[model samples]
Target: MPTPNPAALDFLQTRRSRPAKTLCAPVPDRATLEMLLTTAARTPDHGKLEPWRFIVLGKGAMPRLAKIAEERGQALDLEAEQIAKGRAQFDQGHLAVAVIEVQRPSPKIPALEQTYSAGAVCLALLNAALAAGWGANWLSGWPSHDRGFMQAALGLEDHERIAGLIHIGTETSAPPERPRPDISTITEWVET
Candidate 1:
């Protein structure tokens, strides 16, 4: 029989993402963040390609990225609200990890699988931070998707894109539980 881990199951069941805006200072130090990143890097990679990498964005980098967001937003002619929404996280972030998806050529694993691996890394990092007693939220906005902004701010190459920017810091307040999807409505059991 498989060993049961009730505590792990409970934590997963109750896991909630802290809002990025609610995250505050006193973020994880380098050692702790390294541990979290190590945990996150254990995510499954079909081809052992390790198609994702992390970019640690300290508090000092936030304002710079926010400035880039502003310029890119203006260049794209984004509405004021849209631009603000995109820039808000960087403006307020204490610390974050940018999960970059670096697509690697693989014969057995397809590009879609590589993308999935990158996405999994994002969630893994987010969960790792939360599990380590830090408030964490996975976020992506227009700035993240903007090619020019990513290249200028993160020095990303053509094959690399921002999978997510995971904000991690102390939680100011616990957010109320939101409605969850009904498993019965979303699940389908098949026997063939």
Candidate 2:
């Protein structure tokens, strides 16, 4: 007989994502973080190509990533605030995992599929952290889209790119619930 997991269902129904900027210190330890990474790795990958990877940037790597983000932002002529926002995830982060979308050359599996899989991994990581009693958020600012930043910060290869940065830590304050889309209006029924 299988045991019921009502808590899991309940949590899913009410789970909300805390903003990365609002997250603070006391991040999850290495062993605990590994659990979240393990959960994230289970994302759906078409043809088992596994066209994605993750870079766990703990406390030690934040300064380096921040420095690179600032430099890249300056080169792009971004405003001071814009540059700061790009580097905020690292500058104030306790822990983060960068989801990298790797496009593999495959005749069967399409590149879009790989991209979707990487996005799934990001969500998985965020949900896993929340489930583990840690506040988490998925963030992607200009740094995530900047090629120079990706190459320098995360050491991305030509075929790989940033999908998202999952920031996990304690919530400094509770996030107010925002309005959600009307599901009925968005859903379409298929009938012959």
Candidate 3:
């Protein structure tokens, strides 16, 4: 027999990400945000490499980041719409945690596992925020993928890259639930 956590399972099934644009003011305070980050840091890491870190972008940093996005977009010869789209997340974000994947020198553990661990941290942070009653969304736009943008915005090292930006804020509206994927289509079981 196996012990079951019905509530946790139910929450996972019902979890939905709120749109970044729809999140409003009164974001989580520093102490609260720290708790979420702590929860996120608990994600599994092979060999304890801990190849990730978090950069918390507060309200004051948004404008600067948005400007950087615009400048980077221009430098990259990106279209106007793409530039706006890149800037919009920062423009509307109250607070966001930039989950940075920091690749470490490891002979035993592969780099891909570190990346997967970083991604897991991002999701853990998002879920932590949501569970704490804050509306949250994980976003990564073209700017996040641009090396120049990463350097300009956060002074990331060559080995560091953005895994995600998990935005957390007050919920302005309850978004309607969207369709979910059927487990049968995505899951496979093997007995060998």
Residue-wise lDDT of candidate 2 within 40-100, one digit each (tens)?
Answer: 8998888999988889898899999999999999999999999988887889898889999
lDDT of each: 0.95, 0.91, 0.95
For candidate 3, the 10 contiguous residues with the lowest summed lDDT are: 7-16
Segments in model 2 whose C-alpha atoms lie over 4 Å from true places: 1-5
Query: Any runs in candidate 1 off by more than 4 Å, and if so which?
Result: none
Candidate 3's residue-wise lDDT over 41-80, tens digit each? 9999879999999999999999999999999999989999
**TM-score, each model?**
0.98, 0.94, 0.98
| Superposed model 3: Cα runs more than 4 Å off | none
Ranking by TM-score: 1, 3, 2
In the range 1-192, model 1's lDDT, one tens digit per residue, is 999999889989999999999999899999999999999999997778999999999999999999999989999999999999988999999999999999998888999999999999999999999888999999999998999999999999999999999999999999999999999999999999
Better of 1 and 2 by lDDT: 1
Q: For candidate 3, what is the lDDT? A: 0.95
Model 3 Cα shift for residue 26 (angstroms)? 0.3
